[model samples]
Target: MASNVVVDQDSCISCGLCVNNLPNVFRFDDSGKAECFDPSGATEEMIQSDAIDICPVACIHWQ
Candidate 1:
């Protein structure tokens, strides 16, 4: 199944953890907030889960 990934902009700290680790799935917008640019960019659930887990601000979510 495809994961519906999302990044809570308000809760993001602009840490770049997600962007640096998973550049295809996450990125920084003009505001510097973490954004889920492409949910399907991650080929495995574990990768997506790792991104969510590594987010210091807990802004990344899979719905």
Candidate 2:
């Protein structure tokens, strides 16, 4: 299955956990919220899973 990671901006707290965990794939926006920096690049599947795992609101999803 193809895989990708996304963060729900509405639910995101911009804690930077995802940024820290997946720096190459994630970046902080002007508002400090995590944004997809490389949606089409190679991503660590486990790290995406971890992002979903660590999200306080459970808003992260794999697509």
Worst 10 residues of 2 by lDDT: 39-48
lDDT score for candidate 1 against the true structure: 0.81
| lDDT for position 3 in model 1 | 66
lDDT of 2 by residue, 1-62 (tens): 55677878988988877778777777888887887767655456655575768877877777
Query: In model 2, what is the error at residue 13, expressed in angstroms?
Result: 0.6
The list of candidate 2 runs beyond 4 A from truth reads 40-44
Evaluate model 2: give its TM-score: 0.74
What residue runs in model 1 are displaced by over 4 Å at the alpha carbon? Answer: none
Put down candidate 1 lDDT per residue, 1-63, tens digits, no spaces: 776888889999998888888888888999989888888877666555668888887777777
Best by TM-score: 1
TM-score of each predicted structure versus truth: 0.85, 0.74
TM-score of 1: 0.85
